[model samples]
Target: MSTEQNNIRFSRRNFLRTSALASGGMLVGFNLFTACKPEAKPAVDIANLNFNDFNAFIKIADNGYVTIFSPNPEIGQGVKTAMPMIIAEELDVEWDKVHVAQAKYNKKEYKRQVAGGSQSIRFGWDALRQTGATTKQMLINAAAAKWGVDANTCKASKGIITNANGDTLGYGEVVSEAAALEVPEDVTLKKPSEYTIIGKDALNVDLDNIVTGKPLFGLDYKADGMVYASVLRPPAFGQKLESFDDAETKKVNGVTDVIKFGDKVAVIGSNTWAAMKGKKALKAVWSDDQNLESTVDHNKELIKILDGKEFDTRREDGNVKKAFAEADKVLERTYDSPFLPHNCMEPMNFYANVTAEKIHLVGPIQTPQWTAGRVAQLLKRKEEEIDLEMTRMGGGFGRRLYGDFALEAAEISNLAKKPVKVVFSREDDMTDGIYRPAIKYRIAASIKDGKLTGYHLKEAAINSNMYDLIPNFFPAGCIPNYKVSTKSYKSDITTGAWRAPYTNFLAFAEQTFFDELAEELKKDPVELRLELLQNVKDSTDEKIEYSGERMENTIKLAAEKSNWKEQKEGVFKGFAAYYSHNTHVAEVAEIEMKDGLPVVKKITAAVDCGILINPTGAINQIQGGVLDGIGHAMYGDLSFENGKPSHKNFDTYRLIRMNETPQVDVHFVKNELSPTGLGEPGLPPAGGAVANAIYKALKNRLYKQPFIKELSSKKSEVLS
Candidate 1:
């Protein structure tokens, strides 16, 4: 493989559409790679041979190899492999002959290219399928013209086009002719039953590279004469730099220079070790510019907000006061989650070569377009002067969505006037990180005549609150009298999206609260949820975000698959179903008590995300999401002391170990509905399932996150 990487650029011309066709007309175009000069070929091996661009998505080489470009960033969500499979399926090409390449960011050529919210596949489905089908029809038209036959008589499959008389023409034979033909107005897409490539097991495109230790990730990227940088930022969130002394840093061997920008000092050196050593050697002073907050402060403030009358009512249906006043019984519970650092496997790093002429940025970033715009505004340069290339991320989990690291690299290079790659040590990544904000939720339910009649949810969070749509999700339309209120306590500590965002904890709180409500109503946990979903279906409200029918199916499937009602000697099961990212998922966790502690043994998940693409990848996503959810809910916690993180690395922190991981069995609901998002939906319900299972095994209710802590406290209380 070539170590020198090229800037990912696409054709600037818009896709061609004939005026004779209706709106959203068929797209036809020649090689976007050579759109400026059709006679010229790309400077590659295929340049000497015949090749053609099929609707700016696919390319066919004379050797019969097909290349499909995936436009979204690959954040270990399998969109890199799954998106191309959509194109390959409708293109009627064999999977083995197809090659997948990550496309460069070109807003004019692609839409919604960012990799967040697990929406890549959902948004790209129709356009991707249409691209492939249109290209195939154009090729068929070319073959039909060459053979003097009606296009209706031509059948294409496996890169081969056949006329009614059994005359076969390889796609490579007609790709050039297809390039000159007008795009067909309409093309038929194959039924799910007829799919050959989609809904089938396909290995990840980068699997070999990842396993064999190839340079496929941002950390592996390098350029000529690139210098390394290690930066020293404020130790605490509420502190700012007063002054810095870098005399000792300058004397360090291999250290080139030290530059101070904004509130940070960057040590530049010939290599990573020298830069890091220089950073440690430098002396700096910081002054507290604002209140130095701590976890205790956050805890007290969150609870205070929950108790305060000042609130933003997200949704309210009925008189909650009257319902609670006239109720037979009332139950209220509070759940809290601590700040969480993303802690991606690969620390934050980016390469930047900035000059007066242009700026080159190469790294793994989820929001490349947005980052590019931000960099342009920060550096006082035009957006057109920047070129960003995204590499496969080792792990994103919503961390890469922010471009602060990339911006730092660019600014440092601009100051030093040399190509620079800023590397963040594990300590920097953990301490100075954009974290998931600490949130507290209080849920109250009123029971009347042994039925759940009223529900009220209050949210208090740091910096921001949940998305407006969360209040409209499940249990919103189910309850006769429902209300959701939110309050936010602004903190200087930075926080952004973490995996499933609010639902990561919200689902746990809601699902567990439902379990408690079930007990109060003298009902089974699963049955209670089914009953609520039936209420939703019976309602005529069209504003609810979740589908009662789809949610019911997944819950039933999960319960059935896990033998929810069957009593096994040692197995205890807990069930939870949720809708998020436009996908409905239900999960059942099986656990048993060992040495007076609850140990999760297995997790069964039933997902209804419409259609399944690349079953192998889908299962991997589901299992990974489930495990991530379980690990974070049980062990993920970040504490603050004087606005500084308590733990800076894994040694001090905790994570779910390999031996602690449970077996995950994932099943999908059979449907032809267009695919939604699978990356995050599986995660929202996993925590609730596991927490409820632990309750079943221990017969104790745990309301907080990092459940191990609560469980230990419960054990200590019982002993006392």
Candidate 2:
């Protein structure tokens, strides 16, 4: 969507609503949703304040204290802090003087309360700025009226308004009068040059609380008379609960009751330990009626689908067949990536109190509105009757986008006739299998006269439910005679978004292919990609999904920062670039072979997400994403045998540890463009860069994921 389409406009009727404060403070609320649209207004209990609305309220006391409510979930991506920073910047308030609070979920009031797709900032950029600017304008207008001067002559800075004569009044002193002033329709937002808070390093609002072990995360939440529950899931995919003997479970100390709902069995107890123990003792039996497919079987099915001619064409530019037939050389290869688990630090958990008339749920979730709608449908209740509260999540990577865990908690609470928190153990979380879809890509490219001629890609996967695995992504617009085809195989294994979705695998495959082509053509990998992007930039197309100039800029910046042309004694460098979520990123990896294994020494990244809201936060996000991508490419994988997961926990599965972490340096291309996404863009290029670097170091191309295993076997072969 264009920026204008995403711009939010507040009606005068709902612009600023004031309520008398007990401490003689001013309470100003800004409704973020459209007032003209009846459906946009959520049914909220004004007296009790029970709703999930995107609206924000500022509480300013006579003591110059300011509190702002952030209206999105904080899943460790730093939205809780970055969002409030945006408001504080436009409000002309000092960072230390402003406090932030989390807002509840109210769908009708909050247009988009989702965290997935890395869209929280992108979607809220204009709306949130307008919110702060509008409030600041009101305060300025009030100060001008008090001083009997024009509003334009008055200036506001650091929570203080000053008149031409040098007379000043604090925001708190004028907040009451500002609350009674009319809100302006078009408030002026500060230009990038005038920003005092944005682009500067600011401590996270929750940093102190986190370090102090405060109760902020969902796992730390508690309630009066609330019990704990643990669920026993099916042993394998396509299985249904047949029978269970809960006699021993109920007899255990602290174990209250055992309830069965469809394929899941829940054991309630006084605490989390008791519930887990009781669940283990339940010993439920399941019936496997459908086809029990394993990872081996799924791989074979994907291969078959790829070999078959039947496919859905997603994009076709030129005559690929003619180009391939007339080319001097045509190279084709297949890349495979296995299904991976999210493994959020805090296992899935949610607390719910479901009664006949209402449902109250509190937990860590990415999509509160979508989950609330699903819960309302399941319980045959109105959405207004359900209060879904979002808590700080230890990590979310997209697993919390599903509402199954919340539904399970609500079901258990309804059956127990009390408030209950459903918790999933590490074993349960790893084995349940809502994983990143295992994917295979058959890529072919034709080279003629040292110039790229044609490119073709065919993607085969288990399902296309969460995100369509597009074959033509980045290089599609850059290369001529390009074609993309897709095929899907049916499977019982559940799959959802994991970080960057399909781009995570596509970047590895496409960028690696580009590196191979560069080697074949005797050209620098970075220069070759820049040439393709240059072609894209010179094109006169009416619309382009990605900006070639931005991509080229980031690529050049990364290359410059990483000293691409210079090489250390034994260090090998590789380069990769990709565009996703409207953000362009380029990364270069430096590696050295130590003890027959490739050790990543350092990584240099350059991102073009337009203006940087928080330089420190953006850098942190890029660093985290780089590490996560490296970890997944090096050690992440999940397999199954006879429809049951082969890996039960971290013992069987592998994850990147602190010892394996590499030093990452991040830089952003300076621009005045509006800010884009940051959460997942930095990840896609990390895998590709590392894979290409390893290939350069060892001269052995690894086409499969979990590069550590493949490298180990290659090392053994070299020794033998």
Candidate 3:
């Protein structure tokens, strides 16, 4: 439950059922009794939010305020504001009168609560609007009935209903009348040109709250007697805990007790700092099992397995061997990207309080439904006994998807028998983390007379990362006569999604190779990409596969905006394009080599994430994600030595600070299609754009990440 400082439980729930909504529509209970209940069972009715409808309403009381419920968490995407706009616009109600609230977790109803893929707006766009329009029509019918006029002659506007006879009725006055009517089945939707709420720039609803430091994030979550806890895990990947000497840890200030659960030894304390201090004091030993090693040597051994192996084949076209054999020239380049950390601004932390019946969980999470079930299983209880509350994330980037932190917190609370907030220290969080898979890609392109005749991509990476989501990520048929396959070489290291997942490595390799091909063929890179993007758009199909059409669009836009040839001077221009996460993105990077360091001056980015929900927010995501990609490209690396990670904190692990951030210009391709993902699409090109620019400036190719210095043109030059 969201708490303000005043701590007043208003009539938000009670007014939902008994009052009319902004659309002048009454609540339709999935249950017959709740629908007809006389001002009772507000709680039950609140749970039955019709997500399939757009004008979902809880209340419009005599005060002329309408409360809108938003199911998707506002983790910087601004869904908390944009989603309610769908409701308000359809309801024809004043924006200020529409008081919004974070919806309680419900899977059977809210289809878009799974927030990882950047589908919040796409999922909620129609549902919320239809809900509002339906309810509004119903309210108009009720008002017309009360005025004794034809319903067709009645129109609703700004929470008021009027008939041709000049009889006007406010929604508040017609609440009792509207609640008694049967819901309208058919409703008229607003035309695109008629959209007053969507496609317009609106201030984020929580801007003031966020700026004021309201209790919006899980870290800011407070409760009575909330004790902080910290966990000590294995020293390295695949290693298990052998034992721990907790005597000195228990003597630390604010130490309450040391508890052991499975592999972790947690120190419960009064604050996060004390809990971390106590965790550091504990001397623990881990069993170095499974050749517990992370080194270039181990990766070399893994690369051997990748040489000729094959796992699941995503796409296979005309005989790849025959295509390569018939071609005049076939060039193959092997590319690699190392394991990376999520490094969300807020580290993993969750508050859990266990009682005899239920366990309450609060934190930043991508999939609450999945976490809720896992929490129940970890606590050895039913799903109903575990309640998960999701809050705004400081930064998710696919890290909060890990539910182990929540499980640990719940387990500690269950054993210690108190509310425990387990916050992982920066060192602990960095060293012990789920890294982006160490990926290797081999790209082979067959050229015939300055044209790419055939294309084949063979990739090898740790299968353990994104083990479940791989089937869904394989590229669609965008290239003909192409063969694509994957080989898995598992490391004991826990690998998971970071940004665009496999596409991060795939894009780097594919785009880089594609750029190289364009240069060798002496054809314009943008023009070559446009030729490959030729595909027939399907009219009857709902799901369209990739043909790089959107990618072509983005590249054209970026080139036009960035003035590809005439860059206004003082900038070395570089261009890169990538299609991932169902959206296509292209970037033109303006860079300057300053004292042997490549510094970005500006970037013109074009993205197509489908229809714009909040234009400003989508732009913000593209800008932020692009800057993040810039940092990782230039100087972000994580290495291990002697069974321990080399970098643990920001002082060691590098990030692009505010001063280093380039001027990012974000644009969305004008399209009237299904909303695609934006959370990670922009990230894939940041590296390639910078590399391409550097290549142009220095006449050399960059083969590695963290390119702080120029790579020697000599083939055998390398540094430790």
Candidates in order, TM-scores: namely 0.92, 0.94, 0.88
Index of the highest-TM-score prediction: 2
What Cα-based lDDT does every candidate model obtain?
Answer: 0.83, 0.83, 0.70
In candidate 1, the residue pairs with backbone N, CA or C atoms under 3 Å apart (3 or more residues apart, or in different chains) clash, namely: none
In terms of lDDT, the best-performing candidate is: 1
- What's the CA RMSD for each of the models? 8.2, 4.4, 7.5
What does candidate 3's lDDT look like per residue over 1-720, in tens digits?
111111112122222333334555445322211222223211111112222211134455654567777666556767788777877787788787888887666654443354555555554455456556766776788888888888999998888888897888887777667777766655776655566776878888888888998988878887899999999887776677889999999889999989988888999999887888999999998886545545335457546755776456666666777777888999888776667888887888899999997888888876677777778887789887776788888887777766678888889999999999989888877888877777777778788766666777766776443422332222334444666677777566676767777666566666667777878888766676676666322223223344355666777898888888784555777778876666778898888877855688888998877767668877877887788888887778776664567788999787888888999998788866656667677888888887777777766766556666225323336442
Candidate 2 ranges with C-alpha deviation above 4 Å: 1-54, 293-296, 466-472, 540-543, 715-720
What's model 2's lDDT at 321?
A: 94
The Cα RMSD in angstroms, rounded to one decimal, for candidate 1 relative to the true structure is 8.2
Q: Regarding lDDT, does 2 or 3 come out ahead?
A: 2
**What does candidate 1's lDDT look like per residue over 131-217, in tens digits?**
677778888998999999999999999999999999999887877677667666457777777899888898899999999999988
Cα lDDT tens digits for candidate 2, 16-57: 466547776677666654432335322111111123335666
lDDT of model 1, residue 462? 90
Quality of model 3 by C-alpha lDDT:
0.70
